[model samples]
Structure formats: C-alpha cells, structure tokens
Target: MAVALITGSAGLIGSEAVDSLVARGFDVVGIDNDMRRRFFGDDASTSWQKSELERRHGRRYVHEAIDIRDADALMTLFDRYGDSIRVIIHTAAQPSHDWAAREPFTDFSVNATGTLNMLEACRTHCPDAVFVFTSTNKVYGDTPNRLPLIEQDTRWEIDPGHPFAEGIDESMSIDQSTHSLFGASKVAADVLVQEYGRYFGMRTGVFRGGCLTGPHHSGTMLHGFLAYLMKCTVTGTPYRVFGYKGKQVRDNIHSADLVSAFHAFIDAPHAGEVYNMGGSRFSHCSMLEAIALCQEIAGRPLSWSYEEQNRVGDHIWYVSDIGKFRRHYPAWVQQYDLTALLRDIHDQNVERWHAGATR
Candidate 1:
C-alpha cells in the first residue's frame, strides 16, 4: 500500500492533504497532537477536524497524536510504516510570531527541532519518500517590508515599475532582517530541508507560503489571518488592525490549491527545490481590502479598531511569484481569488463562528 505521512495533519493545509490524498487512494498517516490549541487557545483547536478525518476516511486515514518533537515516537511510527511511506508532508509548527515570543524555546523545539526529527526519520526509514514542507513567507523576515511601496486608498502596493511589482520571487534574500522568533525558527527548518535534500539526495521541496488560508483553518487572533477576519465579521466580534494604516497587503492561497501543488511535486520529485507558493497576483488583498470584502460577503460591518503599532516584522506588502511553480506544474491553477476565498470561508463556517461567539 502506498502510505503518505503528514505532520500537522489536522490543520488547514494538512487536513486538506488528508482529504485530497485519500481520494487519490494513498493510505495516510497523520501526526498531530493539537499543539495549535496550546499555542492559540481552545478556539483554534483542530480536534474537531481530526475526528472528522478519521470518521470520513476510516482505515485509510490513521491519526497519530504523536508530537513531531518526540523523535523516539516518530522513529517508532516511521518504522511501523517503513518504506510504504511514499510521501511525507511536514506542516506542523508553532505558527504565530506573537506567541513565539512568549516561549522561544517551545517555538524553536517545535518548529526547528520537530522538522529535524521528521527529516531524520524519513531518511532512516523512507529516504526516497517525497518530502513536502510547508514553509512560510516569513522566512524572508522583514526584507519584503523594505520593498519600494506606494500607499493607495485601500492597500500598500509595490511600485508598478519595480521589478518585483509582478510579486516577490525566490531571489529575495532570507537574511539581514528581523524575522520574529517564528520566522527565525522557520528559516532554520527551511534551510535544513534544503541541506538534507542536497547532502543526502532526498527528494524534498520547500514551499515558502504566503497567507495560507481556507475554510478549514481554525483561525485565531495570533495567526490564520484571513480566517480570523471573517470570523470577526460573521460573529460581530471586534477586530483590531495593526499599523501601516491598515493597508498592509498579503497574498492568500486556499489550502486545496497548496495541497494540489504538493501532489504535483510528489509525482515529479525534486531535491531541495524551493518555490514561493501563494496566490501571487491572482489573489491578494490589503487589510482594508479584505475587511471590505468580508463585510460585503457576510453582509455585516465588522467592529474593528486600529492600533498604531503593527506586529513586529509584519510585511507592508507581499505577493508571492508563483511563476516557477507554474513553469514546473503548468496544469496547476488557482481556483479562488480574494472575494471567492472570503465568500467560501463565510459560507462554510458562518454557523460555527456564530455558535462559538455565543460561548
């Protein structure tokens, strides 16, 4: 049996992977201990999603509550599946910059060390398995913030004539900038994946994702940008916008689109291939633009306030250049733009958001 192993398997991307890969007929082993709850509180818990995957896929989907930080447990699990593990999608990490400062050690151990554990396990038992890592745009730290930006009515945009107006690509350096602790840790993990692929001939692809989002995200104030915004819109919860006149821009990718990209890489494997994966110019929005869209979609004005200070290392404008991925997987296409993305989020979870708000 072809087995696929996924870390953070209940998360927005991971859960999407579970559903997609199962439909492709791969028996999937999912590793997640619900650390997101520990990092972002109960509202961000993915336990509900975990139970749903098991229910829907049954014997085809195996859920392991093993912490990726626990190497011994990982070795045991990897050994059990052995070489049948044809692919490993590592997405589990402490995902919030604000929360990372509260416990740097916890963040490093989970993000950096946990990744190492997965890499080593794959090398030991299934060295040839296609390893797909969900890295972040934060790996560029505040470098993107230094781009030549022009402020428009609703968004901070890169100067139209600038070379990167198309969008920031893989050429952007990941050095010499403040990366928040979360970014630093992710950089370490991202580099490690590259090294493993180069040195050991492992088939690994590092995907530096922009705002990865979709209806599956258990979005919280500390992370999951788009999800949290729509939740606030639907639930009448007050939202806060930080700095950049609330016009800072981000490109958002639906989880399904990202997972499809992962499958593309797995089929035609590469070693240490790094790609900037996000909606790119196809689907991007500013804080103000997103708020307006959410309000329009949800048909309710969000109660929101702005603070002068933005989150440390937050980008003023960032849209990924997915040209490389497209050149490689030309058939892969993005299905949702900003308005479609927000509308899907609202349609899927309006009921859940309303119920949670009452609590």
Candidate 2:
C-alpha cells in the first residue's frame, strides 16, 4: 500500500485528509505532537481527535507524536518510510495572528522552519510525492483590508464597482502590507513551497485557504472562528466580536470541501501551483450574521459583546475567488453552504459538550 504522510494530523484539515486518503486505500502516517494545547491551553487540545483516528484506522494509521521542528526525528520517519510515501499533506501551523505576536520565535520555528524540514525530507525521500501545503489567506497580509468596502446593517461588503466585488484573486499583492508575525511566517513557508516546485521541479501545490472550519476543530479564542463561535453559543459562553462593528466578513469552507480540493490536486498533480481556496460568494458570514445563525441553531441567544479594536492585520472583507480552482478541477465543488456549515458545527459542538468531550 502507498503511504500518505500528514503533519498536524489531528487538526480539522489534517484529520479530514487522513480519513479521505485512508478510504482510498493508502497507509496513513500522521504527525501531531498536540502543539495546539501548548498554543491555546487544554481547551484546545487535539489529543482526543488523535486517539479517535488511531482507534478508527487501527494499524492502517500510524500516529507519530513528533514535532515537525525536530529535524532529526522527521528525517528518521522519512527515511523509514522511504519512497513508499506517495503524498504529504502539510496542515500543521501556528495559526493565530495574536498568538504569533506573543511568541514570534516559536511561531517562526513551527510555521517556517518546520515547513523547510518537511520540504527537505520530501525532496530526499519521496521526490515523486504530491506535496500539498495548507497555506492561509493571511499570506496576502492586510492587502485585502485596503479594498473599498460598504458596510450594511449586518455585514461589510466590497463595493459593487470594485474589481474585487466578486472576491480577491491571487493577483493581489503580498508585499507592502501589514502582515502580522503569523502572516510573515506563513509567507516565508508559502514562497518556499512555490520555489520547491519551480526550482526543484517537485510537484507542490499551495492552497491559500480562508476560514477552514468543521466539527473536528478544537476551537479557541485565538483561532477556529466558526467553531469557537458555535461553541460559545452552545455553552452560553460570552463571545467577543472585535472591530469593524462586528461587520467583518469571512468566507468559510467546510473541512470536507477543502479536503476534496486536495484530492483533486493529487489526481492531477501540478508543480508550483497556487489556488485561493474558500467558500467564495457561495458561503460566507459576518460576525453578526454568524452569531445570529449560531443562536438559531443552538436554540439560545448568544451573549456577545463588541470591542472597538480589531485584531491586528485582520481583514474587514475577504472572500476568495475560487474561479481558478474550479476551472482547473471541474469536478471539485462546495458541498456545504453557510447555513448548512453553521448547522453542522452547532450540532457537533452541542453533542461534544453534552458528552463532556471538550478536549
């Protein structure tokens, strides 16, 4: 059986990719040291998800609790697997802009240096493997915030006449913008992934993702916006809405939908390709809209408050233009819209809470 290696394998995207690849008959190896707990405390631990994957997949899934920053350990695993590793899905990251500021060194070490380790291992051990990096839309930095936006009663919308009314595409500049420390680290990794494909002629695809969300997310204040919002609504926890009058908009794609795109790229591998992956115009919500939806789904009013200051480098409006991805892979399409996606998150959060499984 071909081996499929995944970093951040307990994460929302990583776990989804593991299940998808295993269903396709590949032996899966997952690398996750549960760094999330270190980043966001016990509430954000992914240990439960890691255990669940091991239980479900049995011997087919090999769980390696090694930090990607440990070059020796990663190299050892790569050498052990050798050329049998057919795919590498890199979803591990220091995902929060706020948290990245507090510990810039740790963020850079994990997001940038760790990615280098993975790239080198792939180059040496499995040069033929399809390498998929789950890059963030933040790589564009605050560039999208400069767009002309019109605020309505509930949300912010890009000006209709603006070129980006449809959504921001890849042509937007990644330079001369206020990228928080987290964005900078991701930028370093993002460019390196592209170069690996272009310079080394390796098959690497960088997906600049928007809000990637699903039930599996261990939501926290600093990350997992949709999941955290739903969790707050379900548990009667107070939710804080920062900046843009709670009108800031985000396009959210379900984890399953994003994983489907990865599968599409794997089937027809490309070298040094970049795609803006998100819900696009088909599925998006503002903070206000999201709260209302969560409240409706949970059958309880969410206790939310607004703050004047927004998170540094946070986008006021960001909806990805997925036209390029769709044109390239006609078979790929979104399976969940905004309402359905929120409902799923709400139901899952409630179930987990009631089961006392909030790990």
Candidate 3:
C-alpha cells in the first residue's frame, strides 16, 4: 500500500490534506508536535484536531509527535517508509509575521531549516515522492504595498488599469522589499524547494498561498485571519484592526480547496513550479468587510477597535492570481466562495465555543 507523510498534520491545511488523502486510500503518516500551542498559546492548540483525526481515521492515519527540525527523527521515518512513501505534503512552520520578529532564530530554524530537512529526507529516502510545500504570499513582502491602491469604503483596491489589478502573480519580485522575519525565512525555504526540484530533478511544487483558513484552524491573533475573526465573533471577544484603516485586503482560500490543489499537483507532479494560490477575484475582503460578514453570521454587532499602526511588511492589497495553477490543472476549481467559507467557519466556531473547546 502507498503511504503519504504530512507535516503539521493537525494544522488547517495539513489536517485537510490528511482527510482528503486518507479517503483516497493512502495510509497517511502525520507529524505534529503541537508547536502551535507554543507559538500562540493553548487557545490556538491543535490537540483537539489531532485527537479527532486519530479517533476518526484510526489505523489509516498514523500520528507522530515529531518536530521537523529533528533531522534524525525525520530520517528515521523516511527510512521506515522508504519507497512506499509516494507523497510528502509539508505544511509545518512557525506561521506568524509579528511573532517572527520576537524570535527570529526559532522562526528561521522552523521555516527554513525544517524545510531543508524535509527536502533531504525526500531526496535520500523517497526521491520519487511528490513534495508539496505551502509557501506564503508574504514572500513578496512589502513589494505589493507599492502598487497604486485606492481606498474604498471597506477595502483597499488596486487601480483597475494596473497589471496586478486582478491579483498578484508569481512574476512579482521577491526582491527589494521589507520581508518580515517570517517572510524572509519562508523565502529561503521557498527558493530551496525550487532549487531542489530544478537542480536535483525532484518532483516538487511551491504554492504561495494567501489567507488559508477553515474550521480546523487553530486561529490565533498572529495568524489564521478569517478563522480567528470568526472565533472573536463567536466569543464576543474584542477584535483589533491593525492599520490601513482596516481596509487592507486579503483573499482567503478554504483549506479543502488548497489541499485539492495539492492533490492536483501530486497527480501530475511537476518540478520547481510555483503557483500563487488563493480566492483571487472570486473571493476576498478587507477587515471591515469581514467584520460585517461576521456580525451578520453571529446576528450581533462585532466588537472591534482600530489601531493606526499596520503590521510590518504587510500588504495593502493582495489577491492571488491562480491563473497558472488553473491553467496547469484545468480540472481544479474553487469549491467554496467567501460567503460559504465564512459561514462554515462561523458555524464551526460557534459549535466549538458552545462545546467549551475554544477560548
């Protein structure tokens, strides 16, 4: 039987990948050490998701509490699976922009070095496995912020005549920008993934994703935008809108949709290819727009405050141009739009809060 190893298996993307792959008949092995709890606290812990997966999938989904930074541990797993491992979906990382500045070492080690370890394991033990990496749009850093943006009532938008008006693409320069510590580390890992595929001929693909969110996300203040927003709405917690008049925009792709893209790449494995993945024009919103949606879902006014200071190296407007991926995999299409996606998150979060499973 074929085996697939997924790092960050309890994460929003990783967990979704596990369920999708397992249902498709692969014996899935997952690696997660609940580092999210360490990164964002108990409220953002994925322990519940991990338990749920094990309870539901049982023997079909093997769970490992291993850190990707531990090369020996990763190598052991790689050797154990050997040639049977047909896919490696790496989603584990210290995913935070502001948090990265606090501990650059931990962020870099986890994001950059951890990716290297995974690549080496694939090369050494399972060279033929399809390696799919979850990179971030932050890789373009503040470069996107340089675009001509107009302030709408609820969101910032690119000039209609601009090349990137539709959305930013992979062609955007990752150079000469203020990439936060997190973005820099991801850039290092992203480039390395490409080099491994191009230089060594490994089947690897890098997806530069926008706001990836869903019900399974352990949404925290530092990351998981849409999910975290829903969490705040469900609990009536005060939500902070940082800078750009809360009009900074982001395209959110459902976790399941992103994982489907991963499966597409795996089915037709490519080398060193990069795709900007997100909702694009089909779905996106600013903080203000999202707050309105959250309020509608909760049937109450959301408690939110504004901060004049924006996040460092944050984009003013970013919707991914998924044209390349769509062109490559013609069968791939978005399963959920923004309204349906937010509703799913709102309903799930409400259920979790009622069950006393969330903060």
Candidate 4:
C-alpha cells in the first residue's frame, strides 16, 4: 500500500487532503501540534477533522500530535513509517500573513526553519519520497500593483489589454516589491524546497496558491477571508472588509482542488518545479463580489461594515494564471467555482453553528 505522510494534517488544507488521499487508497498518517490555537488564542477546528476522519474512514487515519520544529519527533514518525512512505506532503507552517508582523521570528522558525527540518528529515529517512509543498501567492509580493490597473465599478484589476485577462503567470517577477515578513519566511521555505530538489535530486514541487478555502477552515476575523465571512453571515456576527473599497480581488481554490493537484503531481512527479495553483480568471472574485455571494447563498444580506485602512502588504488585485497547470494536467479541473464554493461553506457553517446553537 502507498503510504502518504501529511504534516499540518489538522489544518484546512491538510485535513481535506487526508480525505482525498484515503479515498484514493493511500494509507495516510497525519501530524500536527495544533499550535495555531496556541498562537492565536482561538478555537481550533481540527478536533472535528480527526473525529470525522475516524468516523468516516474507520481506522485508516493515523495521527500524531507532533510539532514540526521538534526534529526528533518528526524523525521518529518518519522512522516508524520508513520505507512505506511514498509521499510527504508538507502543509505545516505559520500561515497567517497578519500575525507574521507581530511575531516575525516565530514565523521564520516555523515557516522557514521548520521547513528545513522536514526536508532534512525526508533526506535522512525517506530519500526516494515525493515532497509536495504548499506555498503562497504572497511570495510574489505587491509588485503586481506596479502593473497598470483598471478600476471597475466593483474592483481594481490588471489592465485587460495586458497579456493575461487569464491572470498573472508564474514568470511574473517576485523581486520588485518588499515582501512582508510572512512572504519572506515563505519565500525562504519555497526556495529551500526547490534547493532540496535541485541539489539533492529529491522529487519536489511547490504550489504558490491564492486563496485556498473550504468548510473545515478555522475562520478568524483577520484571515481566512471566505470562512470568516461565512461564519459572520451564518452566526449573525459583524464582518469587516479592510480596504480598496472592499473590491480587492482574489482567486480562490477549494482544498479539494488542491488535493486533486497533489494527486496529479505525484502521478507525474516533477523535480524542483513550481506552479501557481488557484482559481484562474474563471474563479476570481472581489471582496464585494464574495459578500454578494454570501448574501445570495444565505438568502439574506450580510451584516458587514467597510473600513478604509489597508492592511500592510495587502494587494489590490491578485489572481493566478493556471494555464501551466492546466496544460500539464488537463484532466484536473476545478470541481467548484466561486458561487458553488461559497455556497458549500455557507451551508456547512450554517449546519455547524446550528448544531452548536441547539447544544
């Protein structure tokens, strides 16, 4: 049996990936320390993920409460799995862009140094394994803003006359803007994952994704935009839009789509290859667009307020050019577009919150 090891297995992306892997017949092991709750002082939704996995898939899911920073613990997990491990999906990291400012070093330790530990552990214990990393569009920084933008009634966008109404491709420069602390740390991790592939001949691939969202998300007011918006709409909490007239655009890919990409990458492994993974032009939407989606999905208008101040490093418009990935994996297509995706989240949050409401 093919063994797949996933770090950050309790996270939105990781947990969804686990379900995807098991359905495809991979014996999966998940590891997480739930540090997100510890760091943010908010409820972590991972407990449901674990319980759901067991309930749905029986005993197929194995879990470890292991922090990636602890090299010994990581190695011990690797050692136990040993030769059975065919793929190592590194989804663990300090994922928040806002918190990186408050705690840059801790971000570095987890996003950069912690990634190095995973690579080193793989090198030591699972040399022949395929390593897949989840990187961010933030690595491209705000340089895209320098490109001429056209203001529409609802949002700002790259000039339609430019080569890509399709969206920004991988060749777009990442060096011009001052990447925020979170971007820098992720860039460090991104480069090293490539280096491991280039220098050590490990089969490694990096996916610099835009907004990755799903129902399993641990939504917060500051991040996980779609999830937070859904939560507020469902629970009657207030929601805020930070800047750019609440029309800043982003392309969102569901966690299930990302898992499909992983399966595609593993089937046709690429070494040191990086691609932009997200909803393309077809899946892109603005904050106002998203709020409208939420309103439509919930059958009521959202209780949201607007704020004019922009967050540091926030982009006015961000969308991925998925042509490269499409060309490579023609069979792999997005299962959910923006409307359908938001509806799923809205429905899930409604059910989850209602269940709690009854309790």
Candidate 5:
C-alpha cells in the first residue's frame, strides 16, 4: 500500500496533510506526542485533533505517539513502512521563540536532530519518497526588520519603491541577523533538508513559510497568531500586543492552501528546492489590523493591551514573495485572503470557543 507518513500529525499543518493524503487514497501514519502542551499549556494541546483524525479516517489513519527525537523508534517505523511510504511531510517543531529560550536542548534535539533522524531513515529505507519541510520565515531572523518601513496608524508599510515591497523573496539572507533560539534550531533543520537533497540526492523541498494559520490550529498566545487572536475575540479572553506599537506586519496562509502546494511539489518532486511560501501581499496585516479583523469577523470585542517591550528577535515587517513557488507550480492557487481566512476560522471554530467558555 502506498503510504504517507507525517510528523506532527495532529498539528494544524500535519492534520491537514493527513486529511489530504488520506483523501488521495494513501494509508497515513502520523507521529505526534502532543509536545505543544509542554511548550504552551493545556490550552494549546492538539490531543483533540488527534482523536478527531482517527474518528474521521478510521483504519486509514494510524496515529503513533512517537517522539521524532527518538532515533531508534523512528528507524523502526521507517523500516516497517520501507519503500511503501511515498511521502514524508515534516511539520513538527517547538514552534515558539520564547519557549525555545526556556528549553534550548529540547528545541534543538527536536528541530535539528529530529530532522536528521528522518533524513537518515528516508535514506536507509524509502530513498525515493518526497520529503517536504515546513520551514519558517524566521530563518531570516530579524533581518526583515531592517527593511525601510513607514509607520501607519495601524500598520507598518514598506516604501512602494522598495524591491521587497511586493514581498520578501528567497534572495533574502538567513545570516547576519538575530534569529531567536527557535529560529536557530529551524535553520539547522532547514539546511539539513536542503543538504539531504543536494548531497544525498533525495527528493526534498523546503518551504519558508510566514504565519501558517487555520481553523484547526490549537492556537496559543505564544504562536498561531491569527488563530489565537480569533479565539480571544470569540471567547472574550484578554489578548496582549507585543512590540512595534502593535504595527508589526505579517503574512498568513491557510493550512489547506499550503497542503495544495505540497501536492504540487509531491506530484512533481524537486531536489533541494526552497520556496518562500505564504499569503504574501494578498493576505497580510499588522497586529492592530489583525485584531480589528478578528473582532469584526468574530462579532466580539477583543480585550487587548500593548506591551512597550516587543518580543526579542521579532520582525517589524514581513510579507513573503511566493513568485518562485508559483513559477514552478503554475496551477497552484491561493484561495484565502485575510478577511476570507479570518472568516473561515471564525465560522468553523466559534462554537468550539463558546463551548470552552461555558465549560
């Protein structure tokens, strides 16, 4: 049986990948230990999503509560699947910068060494399987903050004449900037993915993504920006804005849209291909703008306060240039913009938020 193996299988991206791969008729094996609960608290746990995936897909979806950091366990899993596994999507990571500082070893072991284990397994067993990594734009670190920006009422805008005004492309350097502890670990993993393809000749692709959000995201204040903001709006939970006078900008992409891009790459696998993937200019907003949109869409006011001290290594402005990915996969289209995206999140999870509140 053709199989699709996904790490972080219960996360926003991994769960979405599970649904997509399973629908396309692949037996899916998922690896997750719900470490998010450790990183952020019970509120950010993905256990519910794990159960939902099993309930929805039944025998087709197999959930393994395996930690990717466990090399021997991963090796065994890969050997069992062998050449039958057609694709490996690695979306699992300690996703927050603040959390990384608290536990550097845990972050590095999972993000860097964990990736190595996956690559080694792919090399030893399913050498032909396409490996896709969900890398973060934070790899560029605070470098994006160096852009020429104008402070608007609710947002920071790049000069229209600026080369990157359209969006930041793959040309931007990932070095010589202050990457947070989390970003540093991801960089190690990102480079390793590229090296595996370039050196070992594996079919691997790296996607340097912006804010990847969706209705399924177990959003926490520490990560999952748009999703968490919407949750606070819907539930009347207090939210806090950090840094840049709440005008720091970011781009958002829905999980389904990103998974579609993965399909395009998997259908036509490439070696060591890296793309800057996100909503780009089409779906970007500053913190204030996002708060406003969340409140409007959720039909509730968000209780929020701004902190003068911004999070260390946070970007003041970032919008991805997806031209490269589009140029490669012309048929792939981005379906969600900010309003449509927030609306989708609100529509899908309003009841869940309300339920959590009543309980």
Candidate 6:
C-alpha cells in the first residue's frame, strides 16, 4: 500500500487530511506533539480526532507524538517509513497571527525551522516523495485590502473595477503586508519549500489557504473563524466581531476540499507550484453575515457582542482565487456550499458538546 505521512496529524486541518487520505485507501501515518494541549490548556483536545477517525474509517491511524523541530526524530520516522511513503502533506505550523509576536523565536522554530527539518528528512529518506505544504493567504499580506473596498450589508469588498473582488489570484502582490510574525514565519517556510523544489529538483507545492474549517476544529475566537462561529451559536457563547464594524470578509472552505486539493497535488507532482485553495468567489461571508447564517442553522439566537478594535495585522478582506487549482482538478470543486457547510458544522458542534455535557 502506498503510504502518506502527515505532520500535525491531530490538528484540525491535519486530522481532516488523514481521514480523506484513508478514505482514498492510502496507508496513513500521522505525527504531532499535542502542542495544542500545551498551548490552549484543556480546551485544546485532539483525542476526538483519533477516536473518530478509527470509528468512522476503521483505519488504525499510526501516530507519533514528537516535535518536528527534533531533527533526529523526524528523520528517523522518514527512515523507517520511506519505502511506502510517497507523499508528505506538511501542515504543521504555529498558526496564530496575533500571538506569534509574544513567542517569536518559538514560532520561527516551528513554522520555518521545523519545515526545513521535514524537507531535509524527505530528501534523505524519501527523495521521490511529493511534498504538499499548507501555506496561508496571510503571506499576501495587507495588499489585498488596498485595492479599493466597497462595503456591502455584511462585508467590505473591492469595487468592480478592482480585479480581486471575485478573489485573489496567484499573481497578486505579496510585498505590501503587515501579516505580523506569524505571516513572516510562514512566508519563510513557503519560500524554503519552493527553494528546495527549485534547487534540489524536489516536487514541492504550496497551497495558500484562506479560512479552513471542519468538524474537528478546536475553534478559538482569534483563529478558526467558522468553527468558532458555529460553536458560539450552538453553545450560546458570546461571539465577538472585531473591527470594520463586523464587516471583514473571508472565504471559508471545508477541510475536505483542502484535502482533495492536497491529494490532487500528490497525484500530479508539479515542482514548486503555488495555488490558492479555499472557497471561490461565491463562498465568502462577512463576520455579521456568518453569524446570521449560523443563527439560522442552529435555530437559536447567539449572544453576540462586538468591539471596534481589530486584531493585529488582521486582513480586512481575503478570499482566495482557486482558478488555477480548478483547472487542474475540475472534479475537485467544492462539495459543500456555505449554507450546507454552516449546517453540517453546527450539527457537529451541537452533538459533540451536548454529548460532552451529558458525560
């Protein structure tokens, strides 16, 4: 059986990628240090990801709890599994944009240095493996916002003359950015992955993602926007909308869609290519709009509050232009629209939390 190794396999994006890989009949190996638990306290949990994957797919997902920064351990895993491993979906990173400054060195180590470790391990142990990296739209920085925005009922957007209102294409400028420390670190990883592909003839690709959400997300207010909204709505937790008068727009794509893109890249390895992966033009929503949609899906009113100040380096508008990937994997078009996505996530949050309350 062909094996695929996934770093951060217990994370929201990583876990979903694993499930998708297993369903597609790949022997999957996952590695994580459960740093989320350390980072977010008890609220950070990944056990459900493992248990649920087992129950649903009947695949005993092999996992190793090791920090990827430990080069020896990462190389050892690759050495052991190199024979069957054909792909590496590099998804592990320090993801909080606002918090990266508080722990800059740690963020740099995980996001940039750890990626270097993984890439080197692949070079030594599985030189032929395809590497698919999960990058962020933040890498484009704040330039997209300067393109001339017009506010609608729920979100801020560019006027028609401005080309990117539909979404941002790969050609968009990444120079003018205020993406905080998190974006800086990720950009380092993104560029390094490309350098490896360019200099060493490795098949590496980057997926610049927008808001990626699914059932397994341990959503916090600062990150995991869709999951946080769904959880807040269902649990009646206060949902705070920050900045732009709750009109900041973002495109939310399910992790399943992202996994499909990852699989496509693996199946057809193209060296150092980058593609934006997320909801297309039609799948975007503003903060207030999303809240209203979640309310409709949950059949209840969410206790909502807002503060005017924005999070540091938070982009006012970011929707990915997936036209490039669409051309490559036309069949991999989004399976869930925004409404269906909201409903599915709402039900999952309700079921999981209610079960927890009962237990």
Error of 2 at 22 (Å): 0.4
* TM-scores for candidates 1 onward, in order: 0.98, 0.99, 0.99, 0.96, 0.99, 0.95
Q: Give the count of colliding residue pairs in each prediction.
A: 0, 0, 0, 0, 0, 0
User: Model 5: residues >4 Å from true position, as ranges?
Assistant: 357-359
Better of 2 and 4 by TM-score: 2
The whole-model C-alpha lDDT of candidate 1 against the native structure comes to: 0.93
Model 1 lDDT tens row, 1-359 = 99999999999999999999999999999999999989888888999999889999999999999999999999999999999999999999999889899999999999999999999999999998999999999999999988889889998888999989999999999999999999999999999999999999999999999999999999988888799999998888899999999999999999988999998999997799999999899999999989998999999899999999988988999999999999998988888888888888888999877777411
The model with the greater lDDT, 1 or 4, is 1
**Deviation in Å, model 5, residue 213 alpha carbon:** 0.3
Query: Candidate 1: where are CA atoms >4 Å away?
Result: 357-359
TM-score of 4: 0.96
lDDT of the candidates, in the order given? 0.93, 0.93, 0.93, 0.85, 0.93, 0.83
Error of 4 at 115 (Å): 0.8
For all predictions, the C-alpha RMSD in Å is 1.1, 0.8, 0.8, 1.7, 1.1, 1.8
Query: Candidate 2, residues 1-359: lDDT per residue as tens digits?
Result: 69999999999999999999999999999999999999999999999999989999999999999999999999999999999999999999999999999999999999999999999999999999999999999999999988888889999999899988888899999999999999999999999999999999999999999999998989998899889988887887898889999999999999999999999999998899999999999999898988888888889898888899999999999999999899999988799999999888877668778666663
Predicted candidate 6 versus true structure: per-residue lDDT over 1-359, tens digit per residue: 78889998988889888888887788888888777665555566666576666566565478778798999998888888875888889888888876688899989999999999999999998888899999999888777768788888778887877677578899987776787889889999999999999999899999999988887788776668888778877777788887889999889888887888787788887898889988877578888889889888888898988898987778888888899888877777688778878877777678876555310
Report the error of model 4 at residue 207, Å: 0.4
The sequence of per-residue lDDT tens digits that candidate 3 reaches over residues 1-359 is 89999999999999999999999999999999999999999998989899999998999999999999999999998999999999999999999988899999999999999999999999999999999999999999999988999988889999999988888999999999999999999999999999999999999999999999988888988888788888888777888989999999999999999999999999998799999999898889988999899889878887889899998998889999999899999999899899999998877678767676763
Instruction: List where candidate 2 sits over 4 angstroms from the true fold.
Output: none
Candidate 3 lDDT: 0.93
- Per-residue CA lDDT of model 5 for 173-272, tens digit only, reads 9999999999999999999999999998999999999999998998998999899899988898899998899999999999999999999999998899
Candidate 5's C-alpha lDDT? 0.93
